[model samples]
Target: MVTTPLAGPTDRPAPGRRRPVPRRRPSARARRRSAPLTLLTGLVLVYTLLPLVWLVINATKTQDGLFRSRGLGLDRDFALFDNIARTFTYSDGAYTRWLLNTLLYVVVGAGGATLLAALAGYGLAKFDFPGRRAVFAVVLGAVAVPGTALAVPTFLMFSRLGLTNTPWAIIVPSLVSPFGLYLMWTFARDAVPAEMLESARVDGAGELRTFFSVALPLLAPGTVTVLLFNVVATWNNYFLPLIMLKDPDWYPLTLGLDAWNKQAATAGGEAVFNLVITGSLLTIIPLIAVFLLLQRYWQSGLAAGSVKE
Candidate 1:
């Protein structure tokens, strides 16, 4: 084999000789742009996590520790387990009742809403009915209407029907989820192929069978998305429950926590403060559990949108 020396830019000693190229480093400007974004993201994460940190720390402390200790420091006397025990036993086990009520509301409301949304979405996407376009237009309009705006009218309507203070007031209203319907429509239209449905029909499957067997299986991602959205919304709900239900027995965790918070304000500073902190921590457990349990579905469901042909 013949040996060859690399040539410089100007020193071309032989035919077809090439100069060695140096690796280029990233510019200062590119480094600066990337560094700021990372720093900004770090700051944002700290800001978001700080409150959760405080809640965890405070909930572990006794009443004295809560008032006397450094905000982020652990209590010398940890009372977290004690507080949880007391919280469950408070007001004739009212917290447990509230938790059950919340579960009931979310299960019935979110579940029904998701089902209705999926059905409506499928109809709007695939079926050709006379008023289909107008129905979708109305749903779009309803999506823009904030729930806060409808609370008064909804309250009045429920009051006239003698439905106030009942679970139905909250559950019935939650069933109409315009956003879920919209999301399902978009998901069904894109995710479930028309050819699949046509083939099912040609195989002598009825509309109901096609939807349940073919379309619904394909709509798992959309259904999970809608379920999570409705669950979160219904879980954090305050105002509707506030106006509709006067009895504390009927209260969900949100309203129950608010009541505890108000009582905490007027009662001697220490006792009530401990109650509020402990209660707040307890209240969030179910929310976290639900999220963690359903998170796998949420992750998989979200990936559906990113698939390529």
Candidate 2:
């Protein structure tokens, strides 16, 4: 009569049931190990951002202020707008010409490289063609060879073909991206399902149709990644264009900026330093814009590519 009521279902575990165990916090040793890594990462970030911060501060200064003020500090005169205007207007708007040329090279060269990488990577992943392994081997080998090492040889080859001093000299060399092809191949292998390809084929779809309609949607992130890499590479390319192009009209932004820097260093050319700084800032803005705009696609592609059917 005095016995307690039976325990409610929610109050305690049923017979033979065990209570859930709480997760243990990481030990002190783990926290100690992570501290150094955190400090190292902070240092690396500072090292990387220091130059960019300096550039921004200097871009806001006058030509004389660049020398008079601390390299990393702002000056009294904020000539950012004036510097930008002078940068674009100098030498009959030659900086504008170089900017346009860079756009052209990036659009045509990087775009072509991405397209080719996507197509080739898709083929390597899905098809069983002759010499596929050998092709991949060659790509791996090419990836190990630094681009700078190949620059002189490439220049000679292009020169022999009479393609030097032209846009083709830059565009043609940039169109081949071994790393892009390898990335696409890896992404395609994992992201695409054999069943999906079979389904498309059963529905009377041709290979190209199946790829474009079915596979391409899934390959979006990989494509965007390759596109961005090639675009940045082609956009910032310096030595290759320096060797290839003689005409100022054909110079890309990197070469143009170098020219401005050289002029600023010359005896009577000190006035162009601010223009050089501003032009450098302007050159980087488009790349930042591109990354921000395409980041969504890039993230989604990478995430999707990681999952399997």
What TM-score does candidate 2 get on C-alpha atoms? Answer: 0.90
Candidate with best lDDT? 2
State in Å the error of residue 199, model 1. Answer: 1.3
lDDT of 2 by residue, 104-172 (tens): 999999999999999999999999989999999999999899999999999999999999999999999
Compose the digit string of candidate 1's lDDT tens values, residues 194-216. Answer: 87788889999999999998888
Q: Largest TM-score belongs to which candidate?
A: 2
Model 1 vs. true fold: TM: 0.85
- Per-model TM-score on C-alpha atoms: 0.85, 0.90
Runs of candidate 1 exceeding 4 Å displacement? 1-32, 265-271, 299-309
